[model samples]
Target: MMHHLLFCILLFPLSQLVCAREEAFAIVIPSSRLQCYFVPVESANHSKLIFDYQVIYGGISESEENFGLAASESYSSLTVAAETLRERLIRLRKQLDASEHFQSSRRVYETRDRMLMESKLSRVNFWSFINLVAMITVAGLQIYMVKSLFEDHSRVGQLLRRTF
Candidate 1:
């Protein structure tokens, strides 16, 4: 039982790797006059379009067929490279998209913080103005009260002197 479980664990990942390697890709090369499509042998039947350029343009001579096979082998290697580059491009695009999303979220957070600070400052300024007005009104009332008391004392002194 222990050996069976271990084998299954290892086999699962190996199977997945094999499946990944079997993925098919197609490439199309087009010119003004003619176009050619390339696909790996595994996906030949499943291809959406397939044509023999040699047959279309002209029949393949023995020498030309040998040369074409050699060229096809070279192009197959190139296709593998192209598939690798495509995977890298897809990964980079995903990274770029993630970075852009992070930047936008940071901007939104910064804007929210700035608005909160501005709101606090506005409230402070409003309260400070109200406090200043209250202080000034209190000072004015005290000054008027003192002035009225002094004027009443002077009037009483003048009336007492005139009666004497």
Candidate 2:
């Protein structure tokens, strides 16, 4: 019985249930009045025309009135419905809070992972740049030494030719 009641509460359209308890009336104006308000109608035979008007007040239908009365009579059921709705709302709020917490923790973990990747990339780039600079310095020193040795050999050949 409790399960059925809970299922009914979850499935029922609560807005319609609340609306059922309230009474509403529609005020209708005559079409002649509405037409006259927009445009005046001229009749050529005004002397032969006769108008009869009666004031009719609208009231709630008998069925609707009975339904409202029945709803009021079952006030205990309404109270139970209200309590069930409140409990459902509280449960939904707690579920929402838990989901939000889980999402925030996931975001934190993603941010940490991104930071670690960025640091690793930066360290790799730094080592590659240092290696390139060292290679260029070694190549420059080798070139200078080779050029100096060639100049010294040429000078020695010139001195030997002058002595002979």
- Candidate 1 on 1-164: residue-level lDDT in tens? 56444433332221111123355432222222333233354664544432221112322344443434577789999999999999999999999999999999999999999999999999999999999999999999788655655575666555645676
Best by TM-score, which number? Answer: 2
Q: Could you tell me the C-alpha RMSD of candidate 1 in Å?
A: 19.2
Clash pairs of candidate 2?
none
Q: Give the TM-scores of the predictions, in the order they appear.
A: 0.43, 0.46
**Candidate 1 residue 16 C-alpha distance from true site, Å:** 63
By TM-score, how accurate is candidate 1? Answer: 0.43
User: Which candidate should be chosen as best, given lDDT against the real structure?
Assistant: 1
Instruction: Provide the lowest-lDDT 10-residue window in model 1.
Output: 11-20
Candidate 2, backbone clash total: 0
lDDT score for candidate 1 against the true structure: 0.59
TM-score, prediction 2: 0.46
